[model samples]
Target: MSAALQIGLVLFPKVTQLDFTGPLQVFSSVPGAKVHLIWKRIEPVASDSVLTLTPTTTFADCPQLDVICVPGGFGTDDMVNDAEMLDFLRQQAKAAKYVTSVCTGSLVLGAAGLLKGYRATTHWSAMDMLAPYGATPAKTRVCVDRNRITGGGVTAGIDFALTLVSILVDRPTAEMIQLRLEYNPVPPFNSGSPDTAPPEILALMQERIAPARQRRSEANGRAAARLGGDVAAG
Candidate 1:
C-alpha cells in the first residue's frame, strides 16, 4: 500500500489560530493523510486568540513531510528571525512536495529564502513586504505559483486547502470533502476585503495594524539581510 501523505504545520506563539485550523479541518478529511503540528519543542503554544495549540512533533524528531505549511500571525515577527525555525523549514522544504503558507506565514517562508523568485501572496495589508524576499506578491484569495501555494489573510486558509486538495488528490475528492464539510460560506457583510470595506473602516484597520506591520517590516529586514538581500528600515 502507498504510504500516507504526511502533512506538517508549524506552530508558534501568538499564531492566528484560524490560519492553520481552517486548513487542518479540511486536510483531516483527506484519505490516507497524516497531519503533524511541528515546533521547536513539543509544548503548548498560545495563539492570538484564546485557543492554545500543542505540537505533535519537534523539529529534530519530525519525519520528512509531503507538505510543509506555515500559518501566519503576530508570532511571525519572532519566526522571521528564528534561526532554528528557518533551518527546520529549509531542511523540510528540500524534500516536501509542496511548500505553502497561509496569511503572514508566507513571510516566514520568505525569511528562510524559500520564496525567492516565486509568486506568492499574504495578507492584503502586507503585500508590499514580499518584494524584498524576491517574491512577487499576487493579490488574491489563494495564489498558486508552481509548487508554492499561499492563502491570503485569515479565513482564506479553507479555500487554499480545498485548492490544494484538488491538486493533491483529485477534483472529485475535493468536491466530496467540501460537500461533507458543508463548506458553503455566506458572510453577512460584503466588507471582507479592503476593496469592499467602507473607506473609514479600511482606514481604521490599517491605522490600527500599522505598529504590527512596522514590526514585521523590521523583522523582515533583518531576515533579508541575513540572506544577503537589500535591507530597508521599517
Candidate 2:
C-alpha cells in the first residue's frame, strides 16, 4: 500500500477553533490522507473556552510530516513569545515538505523565522507583523509562496486547505471535496475584507487589534532574543 500523506496540525490552548477545524475537515476529506493533531503535550487543549481537542501526539513524539499546519488566535499570540514553542515550530516547519498557516498563524510562522523574503498573508488585522520576518504582506485571503502557504482570518482555512489539495493532489480532487462540502459561500456581510467593510467596521477591527499588536511586538522581541537575534537578518 502507498504511504498516506501525513499532515500535522499544530494545536494549542486558546487557538481559534475555526482556523484548525475548517482545514481539518478539508484535508481529512482527502483519500489516503491522515491528520494528526500535534501540540506541546499529548492532551486535550481548549480553544478559548469554546472547544476542546485531544492532541494525537506531542511535538516530540510526532512523526515526520509531509505538511505542517499552524492555526492562529490568542494562543498564537502566546506562542510567538514562547521560546520552546517557537523553536518547535521552526524545526518542524523547516523539515516539512509543505508549511502552512491560517489567520494570524502567519504571525506564529513569522515569529519562528520561516517567512523571510516570502509572499505571505494573515488576518488583515495582523498583517503588519510579517514585516520583521521579511515577508511581503498580501491582502488576499490565501497566498502561496514557494513551499509556504498562508490564509487570512478565521474562515480562510477551508480555502487554504482546498488549495493545498489541488496543489498536492489534483484540481479534480479539490473540486470533488468542495462539492462534497457544498463549498460555495454567500456571506451575509460584504465586509470580509477591509476594502469592502464599512469605515466604522474597519475602525473597530483596527481598534480591536491594538492590544494584540502590542503583545505581538513584545513577543517578537522575546522570540528574537531566544534566537540570538538572528531574525533581523532575514
Candidate 3:
C-alpha cells in the first residue's frame, strides 16, 4: 500500500485563520493524509480573526512531512526575522517534497531562504516584497513555480490548496473535493482585485495597506540581506 501523505501547516500567532483553515479543510479530507498543525508548542494560537487555533504538534516533535505549508497575516512581519521559526522552516523544507505558503506567508518562505530563484506570489499589498528574496513575484491569485507554490491573499488559500490537490493526487480527486465543498465561487462584489475595483476604493485600500507594505518591504530587505549571495544576486 502507498504511504499516507504527511502534510503539515505551521501555526503561528496573528495568522489569518482562513489562510490555512481553508486549505486545511481540503487537505484533511484527502484519503490517507496525515495533517498536522505545527507550532513551537501545542498551545492555543491567536489569529487576526476571532478564532484561536490549537496546534497538534510542537516543532520538536513534528515528523518529516511531505509538504510544509505556511499561512500569512499581520503577524508575519514579526516572524520574518524570527530565527527559530525560520530555522524550523528551513529544516523541514530541506526534506519536504513541496514547500508552500499562502499570502504574505511567501515572505516567510523567502525569509527561510526557500524561494531563491523561484517564481512566487503573495498578497497584493506585499507582492513586491518577494523580489528581495531573489524570487520572481507574479501578480496572480496562485503561482506554482517548480515545487514551491504560493497563493495570494487570505481567500486564495483554498484555490491554491485545490491546485496542490491536483498535483499531489490527481485532477479527479481535486474535482471531487471541490464538489464536496461546493466551492464554486460567485463573489458578491467584483471589487476583489485592484484592477476591478473602483479607483477610489482601490486608492483607499492601498492607503490602509501602505503601512504593512512598507514594513514588509523593509523586512524583506533585511531578510534578503541575511540570505545574501543568491537572494541578493537574484
Highest TM-score: give the candidate number.
Answer: 1
* Model 1 alpha-carbon miss at residue 179, Å: 1.1
Which predicted model would earn the best lDDT?
A: 1
- Stretches of model 3 off by over 4 angstroms after superposition: 229-234
Across 22-75, the per-residue lDDT of candidate 2 in tens digits comes to: 999999998999899988887789996667889999889888898999999888
The lDDT per prediction is 0.93, 0.86, 0.91
lDDT of 3: 0.91
Give the poorly placed runs of model 2, Cα more than 4 Å off: 224-228, 231-234
Candidate 1 per-residue lDDT, tens place, 149-199, comes to: 999999999999999999999999899989998999999998899999999
As for candidate 3, its clashing pairs are: none
Residue 167 displacement in candidate 2 (angstroms): 0.6
For TM-score, candidate 1 versus 2, the one ahead is 1
In terms of TM-score, how similar is model 2 to the real structure?
0.92
Score candidate 1 by TM-score against the native. Answer: 0.96
